[model samples]
Every structure is written in C-alpha cells, then in structure tokens.
Target: MVTPDLTTSVAGIDFKNPILTASGTFGYGLEFTDFLDLNRLGGLVTKGLSAKPRKGNPPARVVETPAGMLNAIGLQNIGVPVFLEEKLPKLRAYDTKVIANVFGATEVAYVEACEMLGEAEGVAGIELNVSCPNTEEGGMIFGTDPAALGHVIRICREATKLPLIVKLSPNVTDIQLMARCARDAGADAISLVNTFVGMAIDVERRRPVLANVCGGLSGPAIRPLAVWMTWQVHQAVEIPIIGIGGIMNARDVVEFLLAGASAVQVGTASFVTPSASANIVTELEDWLSERKITSVRELIGGLELPPRG
Candidate 1:
C-alpha cells in the first residue's frame, strides 16, 4: 500500500491531496461520487456559475483541434440563488474543500455572487472567473484590462472575506501585468491560462465549427504554455499558484510542481476518464513510495535550468 503525502494547500484552502477536479470538466462536485472518492482527492472547483442560469452557446459549443479542444461554454450555470438554495446545501455533507467557481458579465454581478457565496455555509473559498468578457461594454473589456481586473477583484474582496482565487486569461500580451494586478488587489492565489482564444472549421461545410465563432482552447497543446505562465507568475508573485492545462497523470503533476505550481488542477483529462484524477493520485503515491520522496512540496521549482554553454 502506498501512502503519499497527500496534503496540499492553495488559495488558503487545504486539500487532502494535490489531485483536484478542475472546473467546467467535473460539473458539480457531487457528479464525481460514482467515479471518484471525493475525499481522497485534493478538492473540487465546481462548474463555472454566474449570477443567472445560462443555457450556454449552441450545440456545437466544443470542437477538437490538432492536440487540443476549443470551447465557448458561455459560463453556463444555475445562478447564485439556485446554487445557494439547492446545490450548496447538498455540498455541505461532503468531506472536502468546496470551492465556488463564479463568473459574471459585470462587476456588480460578481460582487453579488461573491456575497452570496460568502453567506452560504460549507463553502471553503471562492474562485473568481473574471475572464468572461463584459456583456454590456462589448467583448474587448474585462479580462484584458488591468484596471478592470482590479475593480472586479476589489469589489469582490470587499463583498466577502473568503479566500479569493482570480483566474487569469491567457489571451493577453503581458500576463505578468494581470498577475500582478490580481496580487495587488488582495487575491490570495491565482490560476493561470484560462484557455487561449481559438476556433476550428468544418472542412466539408466550410463553416466555423463552434457557433460562438471563437472559443477557449485547452488540452495537451497548451501544456507548455501553461507551465511557462505558471513559472513566470510564480517568480513575480508570493501567492500560491494552481497549475492547470493538460495535466493527465502523476508525471504531469510533478512537472507542474517543478514549474512552481503549489498544486495541480486536472481539467480536460477528467472528460477522457471520469476517474483520472484519483488514478493520478494513486500513480503519484506509487511514484513517491518507490522513490522514497517524503513530500510533494520538495519538488516545487525543482527544475534546473540548462547551462548556457
């Protein structure tokens, strides 16, 4: 039997293990009970929730690219009211850190959502999805603006006392500015590379694959990018980082750790295997046992840069 040092912390939330279910892929935390031991994993970031329920984009909302996939989920959710009244009450029974992943088209909406989560019981923390484009001000606003990012975080910060996680968008020219913006705005932690903007085409039909025209790209293709962003952000900020993007197994987890991620979040991998996160936890246990590695934190920023000959 392998006993891995499963305890991991990020955004002030303690995880049972470093293995976690990423948002959007895992649905709500309750969906994984049949496929996983929720308590065995690190924690769960629930599906992106907004101020109101959304039906999401049209049916062709997702499409596969060369080595990744593009998605425009439109942040579909059951709204804050539904989540608090119907969903959060159920999540309280589970023995794990319950993170509320929230989004909105406006700052007021975000504040309201955070306030609602703050009042709700059983919530361990709040993960802000500020990457969403502002609906009223046109699509160019929100995530890309440093000032806008700061406003959103500050409003939410004042609204609640829960640990805040500001998810960054990878579509910016200078991610460091955005990371610093979040850090300066009182965020406890940051999640990097919230999907690169991309789109695919249906060859025969000669039309855009996804009805949204453009969608966020994720999966193996963006792995290297994610690592680089995590490393850069790690060097710039003191807050813990949650490395996501193309993490499929223990090896990937170790890679993220070396890249300066405090812990790892499994996203697209969950779709391929409902039990992928737990399997990764097992594999990590086996790897650590065989190597006699005591704690996973020892591996953080452990990567050695190549010598310039």
Candidate 2:
C-alpha cells in the first residue's frame, strides 16, 4: 500500500499531520523527547504562558474520574520571557511546528504575552487560552463572554503578526457564538471546547476532591460533546477549527476531522501514554492507507448528515 498523505494546514501553518500535543499536558515539548521523536509528530503546543510566572494552585490538583481526569493546574508556567529565552531555543532543533499557548489574567496581559511570543524565533503561531479570567472585568472569563472574547482577540491581533488561534471554553450557552466572535475579532483559527468545568466530591469526607474546588474535565468522557460542538462551530464560522478534547487514538482523530476540524490536539491522553500522540500519527497513516484514502484532509467535515424533513 502507498503511503497516505497526512499533511494538513491550519491558520496557514502546515503540519506534517493533524496530530498536535495539547498545551499543559506536553510540558513545553521537551520533556517528551525520550518518549517520542518530536519530529515524527505534526506540532506541539507549549504550556499556557503568561506575562509573569505562576505558582499554580495548591496540592490535590488532579483526580481520576470515570473515563477521564480533572485538573486544576491554574495555568501554571515559567512565563513567556523565560520560555523564549530558554525552552524555545532547544525546540528549534525539532522539525515540527511549535505553537505557543498563551493566557493572561487580564486583556493587557494577554496582549503582552502575545507580543513576546510573536517576536520570538522558531515559534509557529499563538494559541490564546482565553479560558482565563479577566481580572479587569470582575473575574469574568474571556472565553465565556463574546464581547470579552472579541475584545481580547482584537487587541492580541494588533499585538502580533503571528497567526492567532482562540481556544474557546465549553462552559457557555452557545459555543458557536463564541467561535464567531473570535473569528470576527481577527482570529486566524479557533480551537474548541477547552475544558468543561466540573467538580468531584470525596463523598466519604464530604469535601471537594480538587484543592481548587473545581477543575477542567478531559478525556473520552468529553469526546462526544467536543465532536458535536466542533460540527456546530464548523457550520457557524468559515475559519479553520482545531478540534481539542479527549482524543485517544487514530479513530478519535478521524471523528474530529469528520466533524469539521482541520486538525486535532492530543490532551489528556498524553498523561496516560507519553507516546500517544506520536503513536496516533503512525496509526492514522495506516488507517487511511487501509481504506484507500489519498489524503487525510479528505476527512475534514466529511460527516454525512441525515436529511431533515
């Protein structure tokens, strides 16, 4: 069988494959070096960077659930300046794209972080983690409010020439509205369904399991919901959509592509298997070749819908 073409592009950046390691889970794309060949994968999204370093939340930040995991890491990172000065230079040796995942506590902080990443070398693009709270707006999250989301995207758009991708939060009434808002505000692409807010109680102790009281839910538990939202956003916006949620293997990646994602990010699965993303890349090629598919791009929005009466 011939080699199936797995190359795909999002926001004008070409990826060898649609598989990218999600931020926060991949640990700056350097820690996984021993586990997998970074070049074999399409790209890697760095942990969420802020203007200043963060200590993150207290202990008991992670807990296992039915078919997924919950994390309240509090967007911890070594800050944008440190990553650019240190981690990025090492990543330059890899052939894959390095997309920086940025977040801020306020609009100004967002702009500052974006500006810093945009000027750095070996950086492919910026993925804005708008799930953060806008401290200036009474703690309202930038991803949940359309206006706040648009405002942040617009300013960040001005902050850099890099391709901007808004990571949308699923804790909203309508995800499509937020996608449109990000698009209208100059986002080159949008990554959906960041993480659903959830709480796990100890029951026996009558207390919350996570120290932060609540955490982001990820893994297979949210795949169905994420796929549905991806399809919804695909119909709502014309820009590229990078589907992110609980993607475990090649089949899950195909599900997102058919649902209208130009690409997909591997998040929670990385914690379970460090080589999951790289393994999926090979499996995806084999999957396509077996079906006589020429290119993976053919699967984008390939979902067949039943006719509406």
Candidate 3:
C-alpha cells in the first residue's frame, strides 16, 4: 500500500510529494515541460525573481570543479512584473505545486518581489532567497547576520499572504540562528543550506577560475554539511525544513528525510539529466513500497542512529 503519491503539506500549502527542483537550476516550470511531463514533479520552485530584470554576473560566472561546481549566477532573473504578466499564465496551467523564488539586492526589493507574487494568480507560495551570497549588495550574503535575516523576513512578511519559506546560507557562523531568525520573523517554513561560498584557481593563469572569483559550492561534496545543518535547524525551530545540496539518488533523499527535512530540493543533478526529478520521485516510491510503508510521509525524519558504545 505504500505509495509515493502521499501528499505533504508545508506551511499550509500542500505538495503532491516531497521531491522538488531547486530554483535557478530549474528554469520557469514551463521550460521543462518539453523535456518532461510537468505533472510528474512534486513541485517546481521557479528561478529567482527580482523587482527588476538582472543581467546577472559577467562572463565565466560558472566553473566546474572536481566533485562540485562553483556558481556566481548573481540571482539573474526577469523582474516580478514581467513574470506576472508573461510567465504566470503558462505556469498556472501546470498541475504541480507552484512555488515562486523571490530575491532582492535590498530589503525593499525583497518586499516588492513578494508583494508582486502575492498579487499574482496560481502561485502556490513563495521561497525567499534572502541568503544568496553572489550579489554585490543584497544577496543572502547579508543574512548570515541575524538582525539582517530578521529584517528581511519581516519585510517580506508584511507584503504577502502566501506561505513563506526562507532559504538560509551555509556561510554563517551559526546556521541555527539564521533559521531561528526566519521562523521568529514569521516564516511559515525554512530551507537550507544554500551553496557554501567557495573559489578555485586557474593555476595555469595564476588566477581564480571564475570571473567572479568566488561563488556558491554545490554537489555531493557538501551533502554531509547540508544534512548536518538541516538536522540542527529542524531541531532548533518549529518551521518545516526543506533540505538541499548533493542529492543524487534515492538513498541521499532518504538521508535528508531521516536527518529531519520534511522535503528535499534536487539541484545540480538536473543539469545533466533533465528527467532527474522524475527518476528520484519514482525511486522514492519504490523504496517505500519495498519497506512495507503505506505512506511516504512515514519516512519523514524516521532515522535512529546507532548509539555510541
């Protein structure tokens, strides 16, 4: 009887399943419709949206490293108004959960993005990208400071009625404080950890490989750190946690759920396999059925680690 079709509700918004595509990695939900059925996903978190269109960082903004990738995409996105006018209609037709990713260079920009999304139709919820570290002034790099995190969340809180999921950074000294701040500031849910800030050298050129020099690190290399952070934050706060980073297969998905995440975001994996979400979702279902579980929700944080002898 165990079925992957178990429904999950986070912050009052319901998801058909818990597996979803991370923002930036998955373009507007419509873009993937040709490659894969839009309805197969548990949810779709769209690319980051700003108050205004962004050109993003200059050339050579992404560099491939062994095991991980560095990205300084700078939250490049079309402005909120355009998304509302153009993308929202096409997205609204999809059968999956519709989560919008909002970003800003300033608290005001954050508020504006949310306020706009709030007014748009068919958008299920909002994911606050307050901690992205790639921007010059506002990206989440500032959120490592609790006061700033609180301020940014509160600002967005004032602008919308949709469920708010605050995304946190991994670069902070105490990730818990940031997660707590978001919850305390009225966030309905929390997601972590965003890419770790990292850089690489060209060696041959004697300079950084990426033109931005520094970017967020993602992939299997940061999976342990991400799981640790997710568990810690889930224990510290009352809001639901959506774990991200290095999710390559079914076991990794189970690890995140056992680590206390109510949901998981699959990022980089989608780059090579556009159908990655479909496979992960199916694998999760098969694992649950084989384990004799009747519902996928039963797997949420169902881990019991061995005691120290």
As a whole number from 0 to 100, the lDDT of residue 78 in candidate 2 is: 99
Tens-place lDDT per residue, model 3, 36-127, is 88787878898989989998888688877778799998877888888888888887777888889988888888888888777567888899
Q: Which candidate should be chosen as best, given lDDT against the real structure?
A: 2
Worst 10 residues of 3 by lDDT: 1-10
With candidate 1 superimposed using the best TM-score fit, by how many Å does residue 141's alpha carbon deviate from the native?
A: 3.2
Models ranked on lDDT: 2, 3, 1
- Error in Å for residue 235 of model 2: 0.4
Model 1 gets an lDDT of: 0.82
Screening candidate 3 with a backbone cut-off below 3 angstroms (N, C-alpha, C), the clashing residue pairs are 130-140, 131-140, 132-140
Clashing pairs in 1: none
- lDDT, candidate 2, at 261: 98
Off by over 4 Å in 3: 1-5
Runs in model 1 deviating more than 4 A are 133-140
Q: What is the C-alpha RMSD, rounded to one decimal, of candidate 1?
A: 2.0
